[model samples]
Target chain A: MAGEREQPAEPLTLRRVAASHAAARVVVSASFEVAAGEIVGLAGPNGCGKSTLLRTVAGLHPCERGEVVLPRSRTPAGVARVALVPQGYAQSFWPWASLRSGIALAASGSGRGWYRSAAARAQSLRAELALDLDLGLRPYQCSGGMLQQAALLRALAAFASGPEVLLADEPFSALDVDVARRARAALRRFVRERGVRALVVLHDVESLVETCDRVLVIDGKPWSTDGASEGVSTARMVLNARLGSRRPDGDADAAAPTTSSFGDAMARVLGAGPHP
Target chain B: MTKGSAGRLALAAATFAAGLALWLALARSGWIGRTLLADPIDVARALAGAFDPAAPPGARVLVHAEATLVRALAGWVIALLVGMGCGVALGARAWAYVLGEPLFELARAVPPILAFPLLLVAFDFGEPAYVGTIVLGCVPIVAITVARGRLGASRERSELLAVFGVPRSVRALTAIMEVMPSCFLAARLALSTSLVIAVVTEMVFTPRSGIALGALAKEAQMSFETDVYFAVVVVVGLFGYAANVVLRAVERRLGLERSTST
Candidate 1:
């Protein structure tokens, strides 16, 4: 009878999350959920609380009033299952630590055996990304592109031991077109192969269109668009519409068209244009 | 040797040679008294005499030197632990910084030596007094330097750690590690100051608990044993210099020197 008892499933959920700073509340009563094997993207302008929302979800920033529920693993062993790849990969990786040591620390924190499992994951990721450098190099020795790739690899190695969700905050900001595209492709393949849920924050609409299955636009709040490669147009339209309603002046129309053009170009890029 | 090390050694040798030449010229001209300032050879002889097996010099110099080292190290370690902790706490909390800034500044502005009389009254002439003098002298310097270094750590690094859901202890460790080179530099400087304070306190207080090199030097001065006094001064100087060199080596091994040099 005990063996026959059914076990409950694990889910990562956020409810009514709100964040405030010095009388300015950026994210108010926003909620989102990511099931296993799903990739969600949060896209918005620079001060749109995308990063704040991710931080709250990852349990990095405390919500003023909200709940983040990370369901326990089904196995007898309990684990708080979440990893985050922060923005500015160069800054995230410890400059003093070698790539191997840094990745090992990250992996060890998750209670995973870092020597064998984590090393294999790192080597696989390096091979996946086609990185020429060995694991012993320090962060400062690597270029921005290399560091970004290594940061992603570190996150992957940490999360590889079991089925766990990941939060990546602006993984490809300030990168040139070629590297950004490469990173996006690498992330997509890694996520697909691992079958892990992720919420990636993106500043550029085009990157979300290419990498994310579903896009959630956060201006002052959260809004979700349909899941499709072509849905980027829909997401952009919603962004402009929200921006226009907030502005309401004649400048709204002028700004709307420029943003729309930019979004459209982004959509085309995401839709299958050559790497810029 | 690396080109950089070679250059530094050459510069050091050149400066030493020039200083030696000046000392020789001065001694030959007899402008400065030989008793007051011995020639290089005479100073060397005095150094040899101080440690010579045949003469069997008094244990006073060794005892005083050991005492000074013990007091300085004890005070330095205590100051480092307490000061760095307070610095991290203040750096993490803005209100703490606001509340503690004025007190810290006032305490730092007052030199440790100036408090020797008050400490003497409280702790009396003994080990406690000497240690108190050193701690009172060194803690504020350590605190100010560490606090400043902590404050100067990159905000982006904090945000990055926060975004990763890192616990508070992990965040603090990372932040401290990020700024450790700066803290180490401050500690090195504080070490030199601690030695100076240790000597000054021993000299001023003249504690009867044990032999003190400063007190011995003072006695030599009164007795006009200039060679012995100068020899003791050179020993203290060598100790300080050696300590600094050791710390510099540690800094290099920690990779702080590379970033600093570049």
Candidate 2:
């Protein structure tokens, strides 16, 4: 007889979460839940609080009215449950710290020992991401694309020590097309291997469709927009349309019906097609 | 060595030779009075005499150099501590930065020499007045440079730390570590200013001991020993150069400049 797999209880839950910067609201009120082993893409135009929403979920930004509940693992007392790959390589890591030092510090912060094995993990992840750079190099010495890869590696190192959810804000925005494709594949593989849930904020629509299990759209700046419109329900509708009409490997086949279907779905939610 | 480095070394030597040649020509020409502008040979002799213990009673050049160095170094260390402390405090809090900025700006503009009279009255021509002059000259530059560097630290980096639940103490320490490169660069500037202020303070407010190169220069001027005055000035220039060389080595050893873009 085959053994039944156990499912995790709500890995991440956001209830009526609202964030603002001194009266100018960003994420008005967003309520959503991400199940374990799920990849959710947050799509929106520039300045529409996609980054803000991710930050709020990551607990970096304080939610004014609502609550963000992150599921805790059994051990590791003080480590955070959510890991973030912040946007922009230049803004992500300390310029003075070598790639190894920064990742070691992050791993140590996540309740893992800063040991040789941790460094070996980081070295392998750097290779897996096709970074092809020495771990001893500082962020300043690396090119923009290389730095972005390093940032992803650091996020993975943090995630290695049992962070339930990964919050990635524009992780691949700085990469070239070929590198982006490789990064997307690596991200998918890494997340699957760890069985971690992720909420990725992306402007590139194709990668979103390729990598994410479900897609969520936030219309016009969430915080300042007057009426408290339906947030999670609208995302649910898009997700349903995306899943019901499309196959998981639709992006691989150029003529797959789901590609056009996904594009059309995005057109309605994003006020434009995938290119936007 | 690489060709570029070799060329650079040659060019530097050439420039120094050219400057010395020009100085010699001017001194030999006697266009200016010899008493006012000493010849290079006489200046060299005076420099040698300065280090000789038996040259004169109460006129050993080492004594003046030591006194000036002690005062300037004390002032520089104080500036380093105060500047970094105030800069971290101001950078950490937005309100404190806003409140402190204008006061720092105003204080920075007032020349240290102009404050000497006030310092003299406050400390009565003592060591306090001399050290205060050096601090006033140096502290503002160091503090402002450090504060700006601290403030310009990337918010995304801070958010990265926050996401991993790094403790606030670690975050603060990391912030300081990042700012150190710029701080050392500022220290070079502060050090030069402290040297200038130390010498000027010694010159303007004559100490009762009269044990400073600037005081020795004043005495040399009165006695018409123009070569001795010029030698003392050369020593002061060399002191500044030595301090800068030390700072550059430190920056290299720490790899601070190597790691930073600017």
Candidate 3:
């Protein structure tokens, strides 16, 4: 039943989106599609340009080659189709604007005259996350965790108005465990209800396994000085695995996986036993 | 006001009174001649005389005070607008900064007061020369401060705004709001500096009408009217303080803090 829903006729496509920073190609031609209501997890080593890939798709970072094709047509008002939850909580919001204002601004970015309604929705999302945040508090007044929740709420606010694609770069990195769980639940519900696609870059393999419908893992140092777009440099999906009920043990740190069982879970997500 | 602030205000008042008492005592002791240091009572009398409508035209302070105020305010407002625009442009564009910074540094290194003689020659030692002096004196500090504020703004937040496709007007508003605290501080600094430059210009240039606080101070000093000179000094200090208070009030009303706490 889940497989039928996962395989949508028209998925949101990225036809070889390639991005280079200065002389070095950071995201060397990544091509993938996230089906409707699908949460795709992008897992890789540090400096693999996971965030850069998301930014390229969002059209924030300049793409050296290729383009992203959204599944749905744009709204009549020409609102934004993609909402990005940036990696760092510190830079997610304007220091002068209160959390409520920040959320409203994000909402207003996608929809005209939606600030008031969006502010109300943000207030509710703060409550949903069980955050003890005064919506009136500015970004500097809030902690890293609270700012993370606010960032998520801002993205959710943008998504609430329409069927916008969500690209989250380590959304749960700054959040505590319980808050991360709640935020994940909120994200899932929003995606399910809105029928929008999401590509989440995550460092925690366990959460990626638990949250994503499908996982795409890239391996090796894909950057080179010679400007070659061959082999692993082009970021071909080395493994495309389906998520299953393959939970790692509680003893294992979610960040650092030591046991082979965790590796096996990753292998299960990757749909392979192991990679050399 | 909070109890702490109220206590602070009281302490400030007491400290001012103590300073006044010390000045009076030194003046009475004759350590400094009466011509050099006017007693508090005489200075108060001179203040009253200057404020009186019936006082002699040359001794009356209001006309000169108004001239000084108008020049200072005009120069300060012009400097603030021009400085903020230049600062934003320099900060937003790296190429502009690379080109403009060395020129700015060269101008900044020279004392602003020294420009008075050159400006007097250019603008003929009148209101234009004085206003030009004030502008030259204050613009660099305001521009540098505002540029620093704009540069220090969060780059990620800017990218976020771009991602949402926020309108250019909204983005500009956000940018201005981000830099407002620094701008307000720069305004205060600009105001005080403009005030000093205006008075110094008046004293040095000495307009034909002799219609400025600095002109009056110079006259009082030349005529040995020590009391009026002291009173003029006190009034200038009060104006500076009042200008700062007004800036603070406006900042509070706009919900901007004085410091860049963020």
Candidate 4:
């Protein structure tokens, strides 16, 4: 009788989403709700459709057979309110535009006069990010960390305009430990301050535990649990089990945890310890 | 200021002085014919004399320069606007590129000078002919640059825009801004090419209505006024340098360098 009870609909909803590449089809079907200010983490093995799911949610990838519905007050006017901060800092930015201009462009739509006061916005963003960059310098001139911070600043500027949801796909993939920690902290603070719901796609359980309120482990499919701090160990175990089962040849167990370097670091940070 | 800026300025000055010294030494030694390469002093004097109000002021130089500038600017503006628009369309769609690739490649391969005879046949040697030549030279360069810039914009960012429910105009503007640096660089190179074409077109085909500076220089050479010829050469060099400086300043103001480096 309890199992038969109808589930409450979410502000954002995805049902029976499926994706495919040239090689194979990855299927995903799940139902989840995210309230305002909630931080959700998605963890899974490599190529397990974690990033794919996030990309689909962000409208980057078209779903094979599913529906992604964003809350619309009226039935006729359908629009999803979401912002995505992609994985790579370098890829996310326009290499030609200055940090200030890029961020301002992200903040303001094609309204002619919105960009008139770009200088003031840029100065505030630079200060907020603790970046002492010459707003004149291009993307190529900055280091990786600097680019990431600049990107984060751009995302914050966009978020300021009240996008309901933020989809971050492996925000710390290439960053070093210290920088990643700082960035993760900043992201957490942003979610809290803005009261914006976030669905962060990551392979590392530790980062999820550190930054997310709930963890959704998509080993074979989507299996979610509340309290990411406590759920990290379970997530790691699920990841290890998935890796063990799918790993190739006699060296499968001996090949170690293959969930990316960032994932490995995250495991350590989440108290799952280093790869055994 | 910084030591680096000072050092660069010194290096530039030294190079200019060395070039001048070499020119003087060659003239003094009579290694090259004095008729062909006039004395620097004589060239300077001729330059001053040409500009003097008392002497029949050769406002010809200014007139020629203005004509060339007008042709170059008109052709460049037309080429850049049209080329970039077409390029964005092609760049955004693979099928468009495939469809237009052969025509673009063919047009780009044919030199503007070669196209001059065709224009002469059509327009019968006038401003249209010269402007047509410049447009022929510049459009391909701008189009290619715009195409490349559009290709270079991240798919991720475009998807982000879609996710945010941004309007079509907003998407286009963002895409253009993302590719603006490449477009600017391409436009600058195209401007230089357009200037060269303007001069060449003027030199080869002297219009009945206008005596272009390039034709005037040629006339001076034919009459063996070596100093006047060199003065024209100096004027051309100054104009080219000034154009380059202006373009660089515009590039800086638009944050083109910043986008390029990143």
lDDT string for model 2 (A1-276, tens) is 101334345667778777765466767677677777677788756776778778788877778877888876644573336677887556676666788887766665543355455577788777867766688987777788777777778878764444568888888888888888888887876666565788899877677766776666544554322233544322211222232234344332121112234445565543332321
Top candidate by DockQ? 2
Per-residue lDDT tens digits for candidate 3, residues B1-262, read 8897689779978988999999999999989998999999999998788778887777777667888899999999999988888788777766777787777767767777798889878977667888888888778878887887777777777788777766687788887887888899889999998998889888887876778999899988999999989988988988898889788878866767723554
Q: Quote the positional error of residue A24 for candidate 3 in Å.
A: 2.2
Q: By DockQ thresholds, what CAPRI class is model 3?
A: medium
Instruction: Find the candidate with the highest TM-score and give its number.
Output: 2
lDDT (Cα, tens digit) per residue for candidate 1, span B123-188: 755577777777777777777777776676665556655543445766666766777876787688
What DockQ does candidate 1 have relative to the true complex?
Answer: 0.30
Task: Tell me the tens digit of each residue's lDDT in model 4 across B45-164.
Answer: 877775666764344455566666787788988888888887787677777777876777678888889989889879976689888888988887888778777777777677666765
Instruction: Compose the digit string of candidate 2's lDDT tens values, residues B19-77.
Output: 77898899999898889888989898877876787766456776788898899999999
Candidate 2 Cα errors over 4 Å, as ranges: A1-9, A78-80, A223-276, B1-15, B29-36, B121-124, B258-262
lDDT of each: 0.65, 0.72, 0.74, 0.66
Q: Which pairs of residues clash in candidate 2, taking residues 3 or more apart in a chain or in different chains? A: A25-A223, A26-A223, A28-A222
> Docking category for candidate 4?
acceptable
Better of 1 and 4 by DockQ: 4
Single out the weakest 10-residue window by summed lDDT for candidate 4 chain B.
Answer: B55-64
Worst 10 residues of 3 chain A by lDDT: A249-258
Give per-residue CA lDDT, model 4, range A142-248, as digits (tens): 77767766666666665333446778877776667776777777677666555567888876655665677555555442222221222233322223211222212
Worst 10 residues of 1 chain B by lDDT: B253-262
Better of 2 and 3 by TM-score: 2
All candidates: TM-score: 0.76, 0.86, 0.84, 0.76
Q: List model 3 lDDT by residue over A4-106, tens digit each.
A: 3432346778876777655567666667788877788877677767777788887777887778887654566654367778886567676657788887876
